[model samples]
Target: MFVLAAALAATLAACGGGGGGGGQGGEDVTVASDIAYPPFEFERDGEPVGFDIDLLNEVGKRAGFTPEYQNVTFDGIINGLRNNQYDVAISSMTITPDREKRIDFSEPYFNADQSLLAPGDAGIESVDDLGDATVGVQLGTTGEITAREFKDEGTINGEIRTFDTIEDAFNALENGQIDAIINDLAVSQYEAKNSDGNAEIIEVIPTDEQYGIALPKDSDLRQDINEALAEIKEDGTYEEIYKKWIGRAPEEIPR
Candidate 1:
């Protein structure tokens, strides 16, 4: 874990840029993203396109400024924000207290939790059945933290392989290098469903985590972004995007 964090920190330091609030000081409102987590932020035909990307673009438009997205490593996003290399980040980033201390977050734009993807015949009915199986999770994500916790508590007795991207973790699972991969429930389900029998989503770990757009500490853009978010939700744009990407709207997307 220390090694992973160190690598992530170095990655963060390499993505240096200026930041500003709104359109202040002639600085662009740059948004940093990993661009590898699919159905959230991924490259579509060499262009970033996903729920978070679309949502934030609209947020920027409504807030009276166009946003510039920078592709940063997932582990480096928060650090980039802390250093103000980017003005905001909407990279399916979970809102946690530790992150809240380093930077502020917009009201959650999406709710999510961990999911397990494994072969159909793996017999892994739930997260509990992985006592002796290797598990895969993306580096610096909640899934990695959860997997580590499970290992510490003896819930999973095998190794936890951390990959740089969900695709890599999924590939490891499909190639039999890992027993299962833990990731965001929706993305896990999407990948499994699209895996052509290579994998299946076995369980959804109900972490009740919420994803938010990250911002520099005390950033005044918070209120503006929140206001735009509220407008989108109230005006039905949010539901449209949700349905287009998630296939269905939830009971409610909490503000």
Candidate 2:
């Protein structure tokens, strides 16, 4: 069954999402993602559930692969794929030139930008005023890249502590371990609300980035995912999954 699934996925890859491949294999696809990124990807009811998960499940159903999730740090997801720790990565990953060198990316399933979050009363708002304060970020994310940018420019002088996950970064901020955290805007909002208003959005960094599924560079999975994604979005499945995790439709969010 597993072999059949691989062949199916491989065939589905080359032919576009026209129809089934040669076999109906049940080969499980190991999808590495950070379970702490709520709304995008996270744990709910002891199972992986989020917009990314749902979107990719639709992809799996259409493209013919059984997705089995593996929880890894957001930063390590790509490496996990390269190391064969997983077959695919659907972690709200952005397609960047730097990243493209390491792995291939599917057509953007979503678009988002890095956003800054902080304690409401801290008088620390925006990336500019973050000078000399501990900046928290989710390792392996565009958010981390944004934080590093601030540090490099001396806009933020304090330590840039990269947490294993966004939940931990937010926890650090809540516990006063860090002044603020950088994350995707919506997921950050979800975390803040789930924390009972302890965290607040400071600013959404103006990063024009599109989210894509990460696969090994030159891997056929990238093309297969993009083809499957196009159909899923067109079929209203994308809208359904978006509403399920994000609570509404996605608008044209200007970066």
Highest TM-score among the candidates is held by which one? 1
Which pairs of residues clash in candidate 2, taking residues 3 or more apart in a chain or in different chains?
Answer: 1-26, 2-27, 4-25, 5-25, 75-140, 132-157
- Residues 33-121 of candidate 2: C-alpha lDDT, one tens digit per residue: 88778888877789888888888887887787878777887777777777877789988888999988887888887878778899888
Worst 10 residues of 2 by lDDT: 16-25
Model 1 error, position 119 (Å): 1.0
Give the clash total for candidate 2.
6
TM-score of each: 0.88, 0.85
- Top lDDT hit: 1
Go through the candidates in order and give each one's C-alpha lDDT.
Answer: 0.86, 0.80
> In candidate 1, what are the lDDT values of residues 132-212, reduced to their tens digit?
899999999999998898889888999899898888888888889999988899888779778998899888888999999
For residue 210, model 1's alpha carbon misses the true position, in angstroms, by 0.6
The alpha-carbon lDDT assigned to residue 80 of candidate 1 equals 89
